[model samples]
Target chain A: MGRYFFHTRDGHREIDEVGLDLPDDRTAGLEAVRYGGSLLADDPHILRHDQGLRVECVDDAGKLLYTLLVTSVDAKENLATFATEKD
Target chain B: MFDRDMAPPGMAIFLAKLLSHSLLSTEDQAAIAALPHQTRRLEPNDYILREGDRSDICPVLRSGFAYRQKITEGGGREIVSIKIPGDPLDFQSMYLRTVDHNLQALTAVELTVIMISDFERLVQARPAIARAVMVDILIEASIGREWLLNNGRRNALARLAHLFCELHYRLLDTGSGGLDIHKMPLTQEQLADVLGLTPVHVNRTLKALERTGAIARDGRGIRIADLQSLIGTAEFSDLYLHRDQP
Candidate 1:
């Protein structure tokens, strides 16, 4: 079974997963790659999806710093999560 | 000359030393031990290395904090990882191609220099240590992937929780022990730098966490009032942290 989860730092949350025979394509995983550069960037911003699963980077005063797009996979590595920048 | 008191406090440094002895073996460790002591002090915000620099040595951090950041072509900076006291910086660069990022100090830091020539020669002389070093690099890559997941999919709140949990486990792995409270040295800005959030948002999220009793905040530190609950809140899993099994 493949399960993935994502949410923000406060209280909001979202999760999804698929086991064998579950239909999915590289599209979702590829979407995860979009944020790669932004995650690597040093500013703060928030990145989320229609599902409400989100990732944001902020400072001490609650100001936005940078942003990232997070994704997960259950490949041979067991569980893999990737963080990317939102820019 | 390197001062004995300067090494950072963590498993990363010990792991390096372990590799030095276990991987380098008795004769090689003796050789390295015999070499003249060399050390360097970094001022706050100093760059120990930059992208495109030759990776001639893999430094074992003895004291202070540093982080890994990459500058994009458009002048954007992305912070990938932080180095605590025991961590070794640039091991990946040394073993691989040209450095693709910068290693910069978060505070005035000290580094115990391990010359690449000596290290490589030692590795050649001792395959076990080389293997250990290789394992460490792979572990780093896995951590990178997890950070990516934290940034890509997890919401701001979950991301923060996950980061805290991750740090707690890492610190504990290094023999760092305390109660639920954690003495975090990172400012919100620094947190945002790593988590890819804004200071304002970071503050708001922290406030929410505090209000809910998942965490407590003071000036520069934090109190993890509920560790298990916090982990559950973050939906964190420790499989990727690479701690040695008991």
Candidate 2:
């Protein structure tokens, strides 16, 4: 098991500098994608850059974990995008 | 310490190096590293991959430093970020069809080439390792955000200070130097590209930082004469970095 940190923002104030002890980031990432899935339930494009949604995950030692980022609606890399496309 | 090679093979060594930045289990890391990989050494400014190249394998920096920069249509180069020892310079190319930026060696570099298919399989098999890589990518993304803030909001002097502070922590992560002094291998032009300033502006910024008693220039290195003062000048906080490991 490993500890993970969360940093989320939506064109406003950000949350960071704190970590939660978890099994790992992949587990945490699944939850993030799931949440993004829920947040973007209607449109698979809510997390798009035009929508200005970003979710970042990092490790305790200041190393980047990976991010759920969206540049456009068609971007298939975001958590919400993954969720919408999930089987 | 222990006899390096006598302990294990290439994968084991590679896994040990990754431990500094990841929390993957020995078995998982070893299993992934055991896959096919090619190791090579590169000189400074050597191109690991150029913009618009169609490459499949990813370059994992095993030693030294690297930088990712993009050349504009007008032939101006902009340094995006500096890669530490454990940084996978182009891991994203695993999915993206073509390269968008140029990745090059900033020092005598050591890179390990890992096939994308093999890595994907390894991650699919080892969920734990997958988590670690995700965490690493997230961390890099966060750094990008912080850099954006520096460029958009901070002045030239503060931008330079912030970059120096960020480099200090990154170098410390790589065990490159002591608590205060770091061996800065970057030249003025390279630094300017990262900061979106001219070389002359970078020089002036450095001198300004020195005047504030925040840093002392030591040849190609820098000594943080006053850590708190430097952080204050840069409005720098380690918060965005999310560092907790020693």
Each prediction's TM-score versus the true structure: 0.65, 0.66
DockQ of each: 0.03, 0.01
Model 2 lDDT per residue over B1-246, tens place = 233244233344455445556777656755765678888899999999998899888778877789989887887788888887756777677668998888899999888888888887887888877776776677789999998988777877778888878978876664556337555667776887898764434654677689899888775566788878988988888877767631
Please provide, for model 2 over A1-87, each residue's C-alpha lDDT reduced to its tens digit, 9 standing for 90 to 100: 776555555544345543455687787676455434433442344444454556666777767777776544444557777788895
Weakest ten-residue segment in model 1 chain B by summed lDDT = B2-11
C-alpha RMSD of each candidate structure in angstroms: 14.2, 20.1
- Fraction of native Cα contacts reproduced by each candidate: 0.00, 0.00
Best by lDDT: 2
CA shift of B47, model 1, Å = 0.5
Candidate 2: segments with Cα more than 4 A from true spot? A1-87, B1-22, B244-246
Whole-model Cα lDDT per candidate? 0.62, 0.70
Query: Number of the top candidate by TM-score?
Result: 2
